[model samples]
Target: MAFLPTSYEEMKQAGLDSVDFVYICGDAYVDHPSFGCAIITRTLEAFGYTCAILAQPDWNKDEEFLQFGEPRLGFLISAGNIDSMVNHYSVNRRRRDKDNYSDQGIMGKRPDRATIVYSQVVRRLFPHANILIGGIEASLRRLAHYDYWDDAVRRSILIDSQADLLMFGMGENTIIEVADALNSGMKIQDLVYIRGTAWKTKSLDSIFDDYIVLPSYEEVKTDKYAYAKSFMIQHENQDAIQSKMLIEPYDGWYVVVNQPPLPLSQEEMDFTYSLPYERTFHPKYTYIPAIEEVQFSITSNRGCFGNCAFCAITSHQGRIISTRSVESVVEEAKTITKMKNFKGYIHDIGGPSANFSRPACDKQREYGACAKRECLWPRKCPNMKVDHSHYVEMLDAVRELPGIKKVFIRSGIRYDYLMYDQDDTMFDRLVQYHVSGQLKVAPEHVSAEVLDKMGKPRKELYFKFVDKFYQKNKQFNKNQFLVPYLMSSHPGSTLKDAIELACYLKKIHHTPKQVQDFYPTPGTLATCMYYTEMDPRTKKPVYVAKTYHEKLEQRVLMQYSYPKNYALVKKALIKAGREDLIGNGPKCLIKTYPPRMVSKKKSSKKHIDK
Candidate 1:
């Protein structure tokens, strides 16, 4: 199948004078099903709507937004698959030199806060064009959120972008309804009834008969407690079955986010994947680095139930798990084998969480995920269902397929879920065939208090999983290693907690090459905690490493085994009143001597006076 027209000349070459919708994306145009723009535009095209793309327009050049002229239905904007700020800057807020979404791994193709910038570009050039924003950037920032790059709370992106509508979350169903509504002559404001959409309006009196109102934007910005209170409401109401259309007042106007749509059914997932995707970036551009890893991989499912406080999966994809049938996955595997680049290996066959091939439990479909309780946090509920047999069966089928030498699951596996299952068949086979010498799993931190605040199960579960993993490897006569992903300075992580984790890593003889400092992005429970210094769930005080220096200290402490971090690690130990950890004992985290520090106590008269 031919790819969607990306230029005015191509649009005319396709015998269309005017396109219905012009989609603007910050990413290099890849026609793969995994990309959001591909799915939304293809779904629209399936319904017989004309569409074109304007990928990564130069924000400084307002004329760039005028490509494809003006669409009949208006403009669709996305900040690519990732938030632009996250893409442009590293966790330390340093400007990154390479962007995988750009051609040849170059940076600066998309402007900062790309959705808002692109929206502003469209609004400036074509004042009447309906601007609809979606994708991860708009999904998470649909409401007032903490901006880590700016270090302040900001209003909903709809307010800043002046976009007519925002489709939050996975937009397959939502975009279709939106297109139908707009196609049926419904005005932008009149499309309010569509679930999984948000809009800015001066009055909400006309919208809902029964709705939940969050604290005003001013209150959330000024009062951390108010922010926490409002976020708690947003989190509980995100489910499609039980969710309510929510409204938050923003000065004279309101930013109303409609209820999220239901997770795509198995049949629907299969159809979307079955679409005629060119399955690669447009041929005009060559050598895109982003598609390299996923070009041969398969996505078997969507949504994540793990709901780690730091993850965006819950906010964007929601907690429900839905999967394509095994036949569908196997069909895709056969297709992969036919590709010229086929190396007899499938890079990955997984989703947001690799092992989450089904809903958390049988009750999820009928009753919805429990609003008050998480399925697998604090403790796995007695009624919760745990099985990985189907997943194992799928892997076995793929492995047995002709011309398929090996299939690896690089997408992260939920170790906690693995430990909960009684049967070890899936675990055994995963070690035997899928692992590529190492398996990557996130433990985040080893401190119980830190993991508790992270919405992770107890540290004991991770330790148990590690032991079992090694045992399984031994049984299989394999030598796969576990690469634990650890994080630092999440809310409730104290210097003492960092020290505790350092000690634990030392005991395990596993010092991570790099430790990720907690990045307080929009729409995460941990971000709420990061901004407010309190858990939204309990509104209890949490010790967040707020200052940049404190964040650095915590990061360095996680890699305390490194020589470069010796000074910082020693300083942190002394500051935490655990100078005992700096001595030359087996338990000591750092060596006995300080590094070239002339004692300030002996250098200054003020120190003597004190």
Candidate 2:
């Protein structure tokens, strides 16, 4: 029930000679379910496995890794909640100045590619130890991936990390099975049969399931087309029910990934969140910046069905939605009310996609998500269930809880999904109760081609949603604002496309405060397109904004109202042959000249002397 032992003294104090797993992490230890390490470690403890927390340890030497001596079952490694490469660097591939996961928002707390670095160090120290790597870093990079940092295709993290086993996706059940098997005296090398795991083997002779072999490491590394094909195959097989075992070939070894594990049942989800989490950072640290946001928040669900191209939720959490029971969420809210600093507000009560509280359709429960189609992209599938009644009921219950003043859905709302639902009761309640003055939604791009490439709904759909939102606000007699999250420089976004998006914004008289530049991280359809300049599904050519200058221009166009971006906006407009926009017209993005320059041109010698 106490914090997991982070040192040998704590281990002795807990009367354990050795732990079943040494959970080495890149982030500072925070015992919250929001942190994957906490959930995994807590689940292990619930099942009677001892775990030692080795968080943000010195990777420059192996001595720090020796502190735990050796875990009895294995060394469980994770780069915390965020991928280490992403944690260390930004979308522009620059080293970040701050790390929220670190103590006191410090930087350089964890090494670059922390999972690989920590695993390699542990392997050197404990050559024969069982090394298991999971979390976002290992999960997304479990296969041949185009790493943006290296700008090259890299083999599975299972191979590079020298780990004995790699677990992907939500590992609650997978870890327990692996722990029980390891506890039952199964070797790490023999863990290939477990679902949601990928392992490196010298030979594929032991494989028994019907599996597909992906292109070799050499092939994907050298051939972009082959890489795109391989990525699409991987993307399609993400569902648990329909996915097959995937084998990726290397020179002397093959990495075989078993089909995804079945989605957690509602009871399992409730139990997972009900675990006795300290719900804060360890006592040793005064503050962990990551904890503040989630400390009072409740996660009511897991997984996402939206499955946007730029997001890795599908690859990491899978497409099927797994939700905690309403009673479970309400209980968590009650606990939050009892906290010493209990504010009346509950920060969030949603997961990856807030509106998704069940499977996309009943078919998903039986056959898994349609590999070739999406639930709410291009168009909502006819068979998909479009109801938010249960979600509204759940929220109603939470907001009614004693000591709870307001519950906000800050995670995100899929406006298209909301608009598709015939019943607007959820929308009504959201406007009346949950709007903390502003509701934020993602309308990533306005251009049809760019929207298609991002797997987002059409701009027309967003416009309809916008009108509906404002209409509802008017009906409620509330003056609420809709903050649309727009992204720039995504794959397939040419200069013209960006300009079109800017024009759409101009029509609304709204300038986005921030524009998310397309980040080509690993294991995403968009990232594949960014690397190959081709859509994996159709194999059609796609435009990618690769250069920093061009990407900046696109970003500037999104915020064209700012005077600092005038030069770049003008350049982009002229290059795209929108020179007519240079004049001082109502629809123009930028003027032909700055006020200072124009004033100087009109100034006379006499006016200057005066």
Candidate 3:
């Protein structure tokens, strides 16, 4: 009764045999070219290996795995982009805090659901095929990580999921190397020397002083009760540069090669640009829950130059932007109209910071604007550039495509770059053809200091753009809205800053209910700041908001619509000496006094409450 197929017979009927490798899992929405599946597929094809993607495959139904044809399944690569916790929880399990709750408060612990289901199906269908497991879930859980959110140590994913191997980090280079080694007749045991890969080996007790050493799976799995002791040892010695110990039951040690970032050559860049993409909506699979259905999605560019603290795009794709030609983009649009389910509308055309069509500063210039860091808190590099002309041309070409009724800019346009336009032609085109019932923009934070910390534009610029957008919309009699995506409780935000931001939101009448809390994803500059409070290189303490209450207050102020936030907001405002925003004040958004009533009730029932 599951939503997708699960058996190998069903996979065979679906024409999966034509592929040399079958990527049977992951939940990264199956689009967005830089995702793990796309990267692995492209890499394998580059090395003469045929690949097919089965994104978010339904493991419950046995028929799903059967659809991919004969078991020519040379390898089974699992990026495991979907978090096991998210899949099992109705609420956000990642939001739980240990200080405020017990271990029982942890709601989702079914980490083996997807892996178990996929493993069973794969074994039934292709018993001899190799299966791999990886992603954020596998990486952090590779060793028994202290899950602060769960308040307990969990076993490594290798023991729980029984995957043949677990690949981690930006997996493109690792996956390609793995596939090439296996295809070249290299045994799994022979790959211990490759960096960034983990496998089992023999001899757990002997240790040296060079690599990250982990307890053998046999020792940890000997008794579930002994897990806590082993976890404590690992945690206490996490920073120790111990010599690598060989994993028991095998001849060699499990190795993780910390691979250096690979620079993309011009030829590889050109080849990626030439890959065939329909870029059109197929009615059968155009069911995206986040956005409404439409035809055409042009990839104007790839990669991002801005290395924001909270983003992983730069690490995954690198800071250099790889753009497709304007002509090629238009041709892709033309092909969309030929599809039987074509809707005659281009839904989105962009990549990371879509407006950055060309480099912000010239790449060839030694002393150009691109050589200077724009913001330091989140840490912007000196080489990032912003060019808008290529984007403008891309929009123009798509607009001129045959049978295209309307073109929308659903992908985010970096406001900082867009604000640099000396001419209004880009804005003019946006008004003319871009679908505009609502336009999404990420201002992230409104505090000047927070903005600097996040490597974002000034709050003043966002307001200016908001005013211009409204003015232009009114002139054209269009009822479009600029939906801003804001973040709360980043490294530098304080309660005072949050209250100020709340007052600003009220002043502008910007009541965006949807906001995101900082998640501290790995490899982000912001995360580094949050953890160490020091610049990575300088090793000096920096200003950061570390208290939980301060973070909570800031989050509440970001969404002042909540009833309980009234007292906290009042306290924050008073503490900041901004009594001007009390009740029904000029810049106050909250209208109710329910929190005051609750405070009075608590005072009156103090004797009875105990």
- Consecutive 10-residue window with the lowest summed lDDT within model 3: 601-610
Stretches of candidate 3 exceeding 4 Å from the true structure = 1-6, 11-20, 28-74, 79-178, 188-255, 258-295, 359-385, 421-428, 467-480, 531-552, 561-568, 571-578, 589-610
lDDT of 3 by residue, 487-508 (tens): 8877777776777777676665
Error of 1 at 556 (Å): 1.4
Tell me the spans in candidate 2 whose CA falls farther than 4 Å from its real position. Answer: 597-610
Better of 2 and 3 by lDDT: 2
Say which candidate scores most in lDDT. 2
Residue 195 displacement in candidate 3 (angstroms): 9.1
**Model 2 worst lDDT window (10 residues):** 601-610
Candidate 2 overall Cα lDDT vs. reference? 0.90
Q: What ranking emerges by TM-score with the best candidate at the front?
A: 2, 1, 3
lDDT of 1 by residue, 1-610 (tens): 8999988888889998889999999999998877888998999998889899898878888666776788888799999988999999988899999999988989989889999988987898999889999999999999999898988999999999999999998888888888888888888868878888998888766874468999999999899999999999999988888888889998799998888888999999988888788889998787678898888899998998888999989899889998989888898888888888788999899999999988988988877777878888888878778889778888999999999989999999999998989998889988999998788888888789999999898888887898899889889899788888889999999888988988887677677766788888899999999889899999889998888889989888877866678888888888899988887898888788745654454432110000
lDDT for 532 (candidate 2): 97
